[model samples]
Target: MIHHKTKVAVIGLGQWGRNHARIYAGMPNVHLAAVVDVNSADLRGFAHRYKAEAFTDYRKLLGQVDAVSVVVPTNLHFEVASAFLETESHVLVEKPMTATTAEAATLVELARRKNRVLLVGHVERFKPAVRRLAELARKPIFIQARRVRPYDRTRTMDVGVVMDLMIHDIDIVLSLVRGRIVEVGGLAVRVHNSQEDLAGCVAWLLASRVSADKAAEIEVTTPDRVIRLDYLKQRLAIHPFHGEVEDMAIHGDEPLLAELRHFINCVNGEEQPLVSGEDGLQALEVAHRLLQRMSTVAPPVRV
Candidate 1:
C-alpha cells in the first residue's frame, strides 16, 4: 500500500463536515474515499462532489479507509471516533474532542495503543492571526477570550456555550500558557436556550512574570508584553515596552483549507498536529471544571 496517497472517510456530512469532504478530496496527497452520514439527503451532494462513496452506516467503510474524520455532533463524538480507532484507523475529531474528559481519554489511549494518529480540529489554531500569535508566544501570563454567536441553537442544546464557543479559546490558552492552573472562577447563564448561552472564565497562572494585580482582566500578560486577540475582527494587538498597541489584521483567507492540508502531512509523516488529542482534552477538562464550579443558571424550564 502506498503510504502517501492515504484514503480518508468522513463521518457526518453536515454543514461543517461537508467542508472537510471538499478539502480532503481536493488535496493532492489525500483520496476522499468515502463519506458516511445517517441522512442520505446530506450525503447526496457530498458523494457526487467528492467522488467518494456514501454510506448511511459507517461500519461498512471501516477497513476501507486509512483515516477518518469524525465531524459529528458532540454527543456522538465518543461513539463515532472510538469506532474508527478500534479498527486501527487514524482519527481527526472536531473540537471539544468528546462529550466528557473520560471519553477524550479513551480516544487518546486508543490511538496510543493502536499507534495511530489522533488529531483535534481546534480549527481556531489554524487561523492566520492566531497562527501568527502562537508563533510569538513566550510563557504568557494572563489571558482573555470572547466568542459570541447569534443563537444558532445548533449545538448549545447538547452542551453549554463554554463548550460550543469558549472551548476554542480555552484550547488556545492552554496551548500557549503550558503552565500550571492555580485557580479557576467562572460565570454562566442561559440567555435563550435551556443550556447556558454565555460563559466567562478566569484562570490564574501560579508563577509568572505578569503582574498578579492585573488578574481581574482577561489580558494575557507576560514579562515583556501584554497581548490581546480580537478574533472577531481577525485582529491581534501586542503591547511592548515602547508602544501600547500594535494591531495586525489577517489577510483575506480561510484557515480550514490550510488545516486540511496539514492533516495530510501528518498521515504522510511530514508533520504533527498543531493541536493533538491531549491538547483538546485539556481544554475540555478546564471547561468541565468551570461548568462544575458555577452551576448552570439556566432560564426556568419551559414545560
Candidate 2:
C-alpha cells in the first residue's frame, strides 16, 4: 500500500550499476535518490543524467535512500550490503551474494534481525524461458547448463567463471530440481590473463571465459520429456517421448527491470522477493563446492 514514491539509490556505477540507475529513474513509484561510485567522473555523468545526487563514498548516500541496489564488485558485496541492512534499508545485491558462504550467511541473519527485504540479483530466474521451464519440468532428473562468453576483463575479474557466470544456472537448476545436490564435479581453464582464478566443475555444468561468441544454453531431463533453453534468444524447446520437438511460446520481459520491479514490490509490501538471500546462499554454497572440486586438479601453466 505504497501511496508515494520510494527513494532509491544505485551504488557502484559500473556497467550493471548504471543500468540499475537508469531503470529506477524510469519507474513510476521510485525516485532515483542517489548514485555512488569511486570514479567521480562516471558518477557525475550518471548523477546528471538521472538528476540524482552522486557520492564518491557509499556511506554518505545510505541514510538518504529507503532502498539501494548494490552492484559493486563481488568482493565488496558483503561490506556494502551489510551496511545498508544494518541501517534497515532494503537491498538488491547482485549475484553470488558474497565472495564466501560465511559472509552470505551473516548477511542473511542480519537482514532477518533487522526485518528488511534482502534480495539477490539472480536475473535468470525471471526469464520467460526459465519461468516456462519451471512450470514444464516438474520432475527434472538431470540438468546440463553451458554459459560461455568471450574474455571480458570488465566482468568476472573479481571472481572466477563459476561465480560470475555459472552461478545463474546453478540457481535455476536448484529451483527446478527437488533433491539436494548429492554429488558434484567439474573442470575449468583460464585462457586469459585477466582471470582471477581458473576454476570450473564438470557435473553437468560448464562455464568459460574463453569462448569466441556469447552463449547461454541449458538442457533439462525429466521423467516424460527433455527441455532445452537458450538464454540469449529467450527460447525453450521441449521434446516429448512420442512427438517432435516443440518450441515454447515465451512472453519475455527485461530480466533486470523485472528483478528491480520485484524488489520495489517487496519494499512496498506487495510481494515477497522471487529470489531471497537464503536462496542466493544455497546457490553460492553449491558454487563453492564446484570451485573446491576444481581446485584439486593442477591448473595449466601460463606462458
Candidate 3:
C-alpha cells in the first residue's frame, strides 16, 4: 500500500493562521508546505517551528500547495482565498467568508467554476455542544445566543461586534432552524471604542473592548423543550416542558481541530465540507441585516 500526503499552506501567520499551520504540521497525511505573511518577522518563527518554507508574498505559494487556509483579516479574505481558488487549490477561508456578500458570492462562483473545494471556518458548527443542540432541537421556535467578551482592544477592529462575535451564533442558528428569517430587529452601542462594540438581535452580542468578563452561551426554545449551550464550558442542557432538565454529555474536542480535519477530508474527496461557502454567505447576510437594523435604532446617550 502507498500513501500520499497533501501539501497545505497557511497564509497570514497571525494568531489563527499560526494555529492552522501548527495543526497541519502535526497531521500525518499533510505536508505543511509553506507559510505566508507580509511581515517577514511573523513568517520566520512559525515557518522555522513548522519546518515549512516561508513566503512574504502569497502569490509565490499559489501553485506550490494543494490547499491553503486563508486566515487573513476579514478584508483580505476574498483576495487571498480567490487567488488560491483561481490557481485551482482548495481553500478553507476563515468565517464571515468575506467583508461583503458580493465578494462571498464571487468566491463561491469561482470555486464552482474551478471545481475546487471551498470550506468556510464556522468552527462553532463543529463544537460538540452545538452538534448536540442541532440533533436535540428538532423544531426551534426561538433561539437566543449571547457571546460576550471582555475588553480586548487588540482584536477584530476591522469589523463591529456583530460580525466579529455574533456571526458564530448566526451560523449555528441558521444551521439548526429550517425557517428563513422573516424579520430582524436589533440595537447596538459603541460603548467603548468609536466602533460599535455591542449588539442585541434575536441573539445578544457583546464584543466589548471594555467589558469586565467573558461569556459565550446560547438557548433554543422548541415546542416541547428548551436547549441551553455553554460554549465556554462546552456543556449542553435540555429542559422539557413536563420533566426535569437533563445535562447532555458532550465530548471535549477542540472545534478548530475538528474543523481543519473536516476540511482535509473534504479536500481528499472523502466528505463534503460541513460549512459551505453558501452557508458563510447566508450567515454574513444575516449579520448585515442585523447591523442595518441596529443602525436604525438610536444608541443610548452616554453622559
Q: Write the per-residue lDDT of candidate 2 for residues 142-200, one digit (tens) a residue.
A: 78888888776566377777888889989998888846888777766655654423344
lDDT minimum window of 10 residues, candidate 3: 202-211
Which prediction has more favorable TM-score, 2 or 3? 3
The 10-residue segment of model 1 with minimum total lDDT is: 207-216
Q: Please report the candidate that would top TM-score against the real structure.
A: 3
Best by lDDT: 2
Q: Against the true structure, what is each candidate's TM-score? A: 0.88, 0.94, 0.94
- lDDT scores for all predictions? 0.76, 0.86, 0.85
Ordering by TM-score:
3, 2, 1
Give stretches of model 3 more than 4 Å off: 40-42, 203-209, 296-303
Q: Compare candidates 1 and 3 on lDDT and give the better one.
A: 3
Once superposed on the true structure, which residue ranges of model 1 sit more than 4 Å away at CA? 1-4, 40-42, 153-156, 204-219, 300-303
